[model samples]
Target chain A: MALSPDDVARLARLARIDLSQAELEHLAPQLDVILESVAEVSKVAADDVKPTSHAIEIANVFREDEVRPSFTAQQALSGAPVKESGRFRVPQILQEDE
Target chain B: MSGLVLQTAADLAGLIAAGEVSAHEVVAAHFERIAQVEPQVQAFLALDEERALAAADRVDAKLAAGEKLGPLAGVPLGLKDIFTYQGLPCTVGSRILEGWHPPYDATVVKRLLDADLIIVGKVNMDEFAMGSSTESSAYKVTHNPWNLDYIPGGSSGGSAAALAAFEVALSVGTDTGGSIRQPAAVNSLVGVKPTYGSNSRFGVVAMASSLDVPGPFGRTVLDAALLHEAISGYDPMDSTSLNLPIPPVAQAARSGEIKGYRIGVVKELGGEGYAPGVLQRFNESLALLESAGAEIAEISCPHFTYALGAYYLIMPSEVSSNLARFDAMRYGIRVGDDGKRSAEEVMNLTRGAGFGAEVKRRVIIGTYALSAGYYDAYYGSALKVRTLIQQDFDAAFAKVDVLVSPTSPTTAWKIGERLDDPLAMYKADLCTIPANLAGICAASIPVGLSSENGLPVGFQIMAPAMADDRLYRVGAALERGVADAFGGPVLNQLIGSPAWDALSAQAVAARFPNIILGLAENLS
Candidate 1:
């Protein structure tokens, strides 16, 4: 199915990426081509076939619950683009009056 | 000690062990080579000369104290930018993580260090490992050492180019789709994608969590096997890592015998759309194997045709989910973060500014595929198709001990040839994706030069999961047989080529003048 520009915009929002109008227009047709090409999967995949999430077979893996040396707060926050008081600082989440 | 950069990893290890050369000398030789050729090849994104020399010094000190060094001691390596090395940038070839230095090392990085391999630098890749060529990298474009005008297939292009240029004997690369294998194929190097879960992914930046696997590259089969042995095995840090003992691949590579082995040629991989020169080399390798007493059979994997289509759907779906962690609040570059703006706005602005066109395209496609109405039609069906592809492998392996195919459909194209067409780029991985979907081991070894372009073509050898040794044995045998036919290793043809020397002296800006300047301006 051909994706409309509105559909592309909705996807960009869902993905939390802000796409310019030109980007949405450019990507819509490419996404449509990719989507149509990949639609071939529907032709051969049988109903009984089990979908594979992880290619390898491993069950819930457990490690010892013993405490070990972990990254210090400073090290953990080193790469943060915005940090304050040993925490990741972000733009305000809630509005002033809300 | 002269020409030390040209030695194989195994040979260098032997030299280091026997006290013929110090690890420091080996590391210095590689750094010299890098300084010479890196300008032309554009293989490295970042180089920590002090850190690499310090690491090499430690190895020399250990040897002086009479302590036995690791198996691959003194071999210089190029670490792909995706794998984190503490205090070094882990950009994963995207502007989103441009100067983000990780606090910890990737499991593979630590393992390679413990084995005493001096890491020369972090190499370039396609942005977030998204594209077939390194053209999508937000940084410099990596040129194929053989010819500057053509690409070194990616997203492991830098790693492959490093080996081809003799800048490093070994390098680490991740194969989410054909990243490792395809680059190695075009560059005339050896690349391995171990069975899924065989290598830990603790700190390698995830492109597709289910498909991302860190592997090794070398100019020779045994060299790749040695590096593979150093980096692979189960890691508790990675939940999906297999807990079984790593296969004895180094020994198998040394043995180089595949006598009486059953080799199956996949009917789907190499007929239509395959370049003539690629097919010729592939058939010659098959004939060589048959003459060596191996049984060759034509096997049909009908579902293989759909593997590429399935991969595009599933890989992007996982890419979208995996890449969501790069919000503006933490890590790397943030944009439009005025105090008055909301966190959501800042995130959207940062993502919009940071991610490249290819990355944005995949993310949108993935979001649409996983959206409410399209999940079953796209992502769900892709998963089912993965099962069908795996089943095809199971049926094929039941008849043959291993499978063989062309690593890629053709030789490397000119740098800008496929930039406008994403679908054409995706088709480059068609021959290599089925093995990833099946969770098996596959390696690409240089077959011969393409008669058409005089560029290298790789012959892929695949073995069942946990049967990785079989791939090495067959690959080594083919390498030995083909080396004898060609007078020496296939890469030997590239050693003194005037084209390589001329390309090495030319600046990358000269090749893509306007585009690179535009990228530089954007980054600034």
Candidate 2:
């Protein structure tokens, strides 16, 4: 259950939050303690026990898709920091690698 | 009309029904109160005078037309910003979704509207309901009304503080771990977190979907129960919402009989690590309840010792999954990345810039928990722990009709005391976490003030799932006993009636310098 520095670094990368050197150093030990604390939960839980996912037992509640009046195209772009031609404009994705 | 701020929603309704006061007059009085105290308290995030007045007019119109209105007709309510409304922004206190208006009202909001409750405004919260203190709020930290320098327990701090400050009669707040109860404890307000699925979560901005529940906040136990009764019950739009009929919570509150009830004081909670003053007040509350003809005894639930640890795991893991939808493409705020950069890069830049430090910490921990090679070691095992905790409550409830504990381990601490230490912040939730882990109903009632600091302490009451009414009955009786001994609800005696002039311009200037300057400039 021990998490290495590399594992911590990988998690930071996966979560997309840029961590400082101090944060990486601090988190390594804190996360280790947290893992150790939670590891105890694994002991008493049986293989026969069903995992509780939701506080209440629930299931799929889907609605049929239908055309409905929505915020105007202009209104949708109102809050954006950058926009163009009724669509959200972002940094380009295509490159020579393709 | 003299103490309408302290009157329960039921009493207010009766007054309105008898023509003692018009809905318009009530709304206007509350608005004047908000104008006075809101500057120092920062209880509301958004307030539309037009909407509140319009809603009041509609209620007055109904009465004039000779039509009977619903139970909470014209009663003003403050909504936690996390709950979605049709036009109002529901940010979850995260900049990533800033200014994003929901397409429709959350099911709980819709239910409140159906009951004719007036929405006074939206309240501030911890960013995406991530922290135990309101200091983690991105916009501004909410201060405890008891001591202006101390923190109001959060992420429902604004809702609790609103009740304490008398800015609103009632509010709806969501609790994932101890958001509602902890704040209520610190602010000396009555707050309830009903059994999971008792209220619908259809359009609430998700934090940890499995753990999140919407509940009521009020100045009195019966007020909270009446609000809870109006907003709870089945909603076809919410799959997780219980179809079972809700018990009459207000009726239970009116019943003073607890002679046959057996209340178990959790042996695990009132132990070492609790502030001495907090424990003293809690025992006093127990004595008051005992004097009211209820039998009190000790009970043990060993699994509770590890509830906080398991809660951090399960909640953050769900948070990682739930917040994934807020990428730069589909949502509010987006940061650009180079053309060669992957989608992950764009997501990272957006999230890293948008989220606060605590939120980032949780996202990293959650992502690690759900990572490919670590799923079994983290998320999977945490779910198993949750089931065991639920079973522990189930077994404990078999021996006792209800359980009791101190709502919080300590009174509200000074603002910066634990801000630098996240572990200490997480530890504050120790006494409150078990109820959330067990999916049981819990309420926090202010029992007495601490001798050392003169701050309030709350006693926690818990009941098994779907036995929320039992909590109301016990809590109401306890509230009456404690209040009678203290001469009043303590909160009201000190804060006094809400007034437009007492919340001085100097206090407002000191607390919200920039906001006042902006308002003055706008006026000039």
Q: Quick one: best DockQ, which candidate? A: 1
Per-residue lDDT of candidate 2, residues A1-98 (tens digit)? 67777777788787776566777777777777766766676676678877887766667766678886767877666555457788887655555566
- Give the Cα-based TM-score of candidate 1 against the true structure: 0.96
Scored by Cα lDDT, where does model 2 land? 0.79
Q: What is residue B187's positional error in candidate 2, in angstroms?
A: 0.8
Clashing pairs in 2: none
Model 1, B1-524: lDDT tens per residue?
15898889899989998999999999887777776777888888888778788988899899989999877987889999999998677888888887787899999999998898988888899999987789999888999998988899999999999889998889999999999999999999999999999999999999998998999999999999999999999898999999899889999999988788999999999889999999999999999888888999999999999999999989999989998999967787888877888889888988998999999989888887898988998899999999988889999999999999999999999999999799999989999999998889999999889999999999999899999999899999999989988999999999878866764574332211111111111231
Residue B212 accuracy (lDDT) in model 1 = 88
lDDT of 2 by residue, B59-123 (tens): 98888899898878988888898998865777777777776666667888888888888887888
Native contacts retained, all candidates in order: 0.89, 0.48
TM-score of each: 0.96, 0.91
Question: Per candidate, chain B TM-score?
Answer: 0.96, 0.93
Per-residue lDDT value at B164 in model 1: 92
